[model samples]
Target: MARDYAARCPVYPVRNAWLVAVAVLLAAQEIGAPKVQVAEELEAYPTESVELSCQFNDGGGLTKLTQVSWIWEPSDGHRDNIAVYHPVYGQSFPNVAFKDRVVFLHNSLENPSIRISNLRMSDAGRYTCEYATYPTGNEQGTTTLIMLSKPKNSANGVTVQAGTKSVVVARCEAADAKPAATIEWLAPVGGNHSTSTTSGPDGTVTVRSEYRLVPTPADNGREVICRVNQKTQKQPWVYPIKLSVEYLPSVSIEGYDHNWYVGRSDATLVCLANANPEPTTITWTAASGPLPETVVVEGNKLTVRKVDDAVNTTFICEVKNRLGSSRHQITTVVIEALEDPSSAGVVAGAVIGSLLALLLVVALIAVLLTRSRRQQRRGYPSSGDSIATGSGGSNGGDYGNKARLLFSNSGNNSSKNGTGTNNNGPIYTYREGCDATGTLTEKANDYHHHHLHHASTGNAPTAHDILLSSEMDEAERRKFDLDDSMEEEEERYDRFGGVAGGGNILPPAYHVHRGHAGEEMDVYLDDDMESQRDGSVISRTAIYV
Candidate 1:
């Protein structure tokens, strides 16, 4: 009977307070009035269940409940029946699907509550509950139900390239919510970014944020986050966007500014650069001069085998990547010729000094050679003038005054050579010079090997040698100027013939040859005295008688 009344009875929505008061008055019926109430509002998320209850006089004595009816009135539609309930004849549902999920919490006749399961966005509206009493007529109340839903896969990662005049846009959505969500975008580098939001018919909001980034090397790996905040969610949904940037190479030459000499050393130039997706190739070129003979290029390194042509050249090292190319220059100079005045002065001075030293050495060698030849001809020792005195001839080492030598018998010319005693004496010949220099050693060497008897037994042979008497002016007794080439010749007169005239000052003797008996000429000792070998210092004095 209750199921039939619910299926045939007409129900009106409790739209306003006036309709609610009328239903309360009808249910009272002059008996003790019962309080009829339902939940003021219902809040639920998507895919959840909700219960609408109406408790009339819960003390259980004022009114007895017969059946319960439910109503749903959309804002744009008319009132409609949801279901009805009875206690004794078993409950019935308008739709068979509602019967399995709807359970009543009817502990007493005053409480008749119905539960709705698997609610959707379309179920979000005001619901009305009407309770019929036994002694009273009927009472009705209302409840507002709201369902919250969010879009799936709404927070997706976005890839964006960061560049000048470049923009990256991403959208984040939160759907089927009671109220629209607040939208915001947070960038990694900059502060807050601007965002745009749109609402759907179901009160959901989508936030789309556009970021215009002026990228430098500093902003390569940054992230831009897009966020949407809803009242139902614990935390805001955040979508991060990737920022990729491509840039040109910043290049520099590894080896720079060098000074080198020609044909001395080689130079190597390397290109150093920093770029994304490391550089592919690096080439080296020169402003002037041909390429080196042996040129080897290895990645960033370029080696020039010989720097023979590197005369004030600017070598450019170019580095290339996918983005762009950049180059750096290294200036070099090879000194083919130097015209520095100070440096040239120093070199010239060194060369001149060397030449002077060489000339001095050659002059010394010539002097040495001439001295050597003179020594060989005169038989001299190098250290000044020296003498060996003892045995002469083959026994030159003996240091003595006189020693006899075994010469040929033909050397005996006693009549022409010596004084009255010892007619046969060792003969000697020596040449002497007056020079004070070391060449005077020739005179000393002449006396070394010759065996000459000294005049120790009697007065020595009186001899006088006048040098260059013709160059002296006899009238004025002054020396006449003579040329440097003119050498003084010695005029020696000796009175020591082999005649047996034993007088201190013998008269100048003359020997009359058999063919020229009438024309007689003076005769002297056969040879002049050699250099004294007895280490004696000889002194001469002239006495004019």
Candidate 2:
């Protein structure tokens, strides 16, 4: 295989010539491309200093660094050479707008960064770092400089008269801001707001807002806030103000209690008014006639020295402001006595209490009467004779014994009927005796062996039954007299067939009395007899024959 290859070596030399040509083309492309480094964007506040950085890359030393320049390009597409730096010629500021404000930092073409002092809003523009190289020509990079200005905010309310049509009540503004500010309004009441913007020559904008409403008296002193939002501020600036709306004076009178009475003092009436401008004049008058001498007028108050008949009239209070005047009236009536509102309740309560007390008393009396009747029904025991015998005088015992013996003799003398019907009236003795005070005093321990029966037939009550009846009213019982008892006794004798002329019954007028005992006695019929002190009738003669 190591034989002579002279013909193949000639083809290899032709391929090597093409490879060498491609290498030279790539080497020239890399040498001609150079780079200038700068930030894409930058920010600074007004009147503050900022550095625009720029650096040139000569593509691995294939191209040479010549001179570097800083150019200002505004948004309007206008360019100016502001600063330039060269290794031999040093640094130069060509633009008069940046002559004293901009300077080259390093005085070398590799790093041509510039420091801009006393920055203004107008200085906000795109800055270009341009490099002039030998074979690569011009290489550039741009950086935008943003200048921020925080807005000064203010708000105020306008004074307006109350009207039907809508008017501006408040205004807010944010002035001298680089970026336009957005405005908004906050009001509790019903209203509308509008906004506008203005631009300044130095790239600052002014924002304004107005709040409008149909002004009314109620809208006065209402708080409204204006909020401004700008790019330069972290939080929105708020301004608060109050609206002022004026109207006519609304007047009224106060402090009348309707309890003004004669001889009463410390009464007063005050004139109250609502107006934007305070009321200037307050007047008091009387509709019936001139004001009373008891009334003392000072400012808006009318004080009464003393209430009297002359104060019983209509009173008027008038007030006037800058806008208009208003008045109020009250009718007063001086009464002879103070009208106490709680007096009616007190009277009603007293009446109720009295009625309750009366009911309690009635219940107590009923209980006492019931207990007394129960004792009587049980045959109440006593220490003396079973029959109720009274001792009106020293001979009272002898009189009672003789009367009982007479009654026994009469019962035995009565004859039997033809049918042997036992026709004899029952003799009844008093179960209780009364005193002069109309109260029963004597009580019987036992009902003596005296027969008692009803006068008429058919279940009618007897005299003894009527006397013991609890249903009888106390007042009616007090009206009972000895004459009535005698009449009842005579009826009973007749019913039982007692012959009055045959001496079977005692005479109705028969009486026993002890005048020396000082006992007052009577038997009543047609008001001829007077009442007895012991409520008993006695025969004046003690002879039973």
lDDT of each: 0.52, 0.66
What digit string (tens of lDDT, one per residue) describes model 2 on residues 25-103? 8898766644888899999998899999988766567878788888899879999999888788888888998879987
The worst-scoring run of ten residues by lDDT in candidate 2 lies at: 436-445
* Overall local distance difference test of candidate 2: 0.66
Best of the candidates, lDDT: 2
TM-score of each: 0.47, 0.63
Compute the lDDT of residue 353 as modeled in candidate 2: 100
RMSD values, in order shown: 21.4, 13.9
Write the residue-wise lDDT of candidate 1 on 1-545 in tens digits. Answer: 99899889756565676788988897676345436778889888756888788876645466677877777866566677677777776555665535566677664445668888887666777888888776758878889887777644254433443356545434455544456666666776663345566766654555554565556666666676767777777777777866665667789887644655555445677788877646888887777765555557777787766556544577788878887788888777776635554487899999999999999999999998987655433322233333221111221221222111111112333222223233322222221112211110121112222323332452222211111223212431212223322112110111111212322222232232222133433333222222323222211111111
Q: Residue 474 of candidate 2: its Cα lDDT?
A: 61
What is candidate 2's CA lDDT for residue 238? 87
Q: Pick the candidate with the highest TM-score.
A: 2
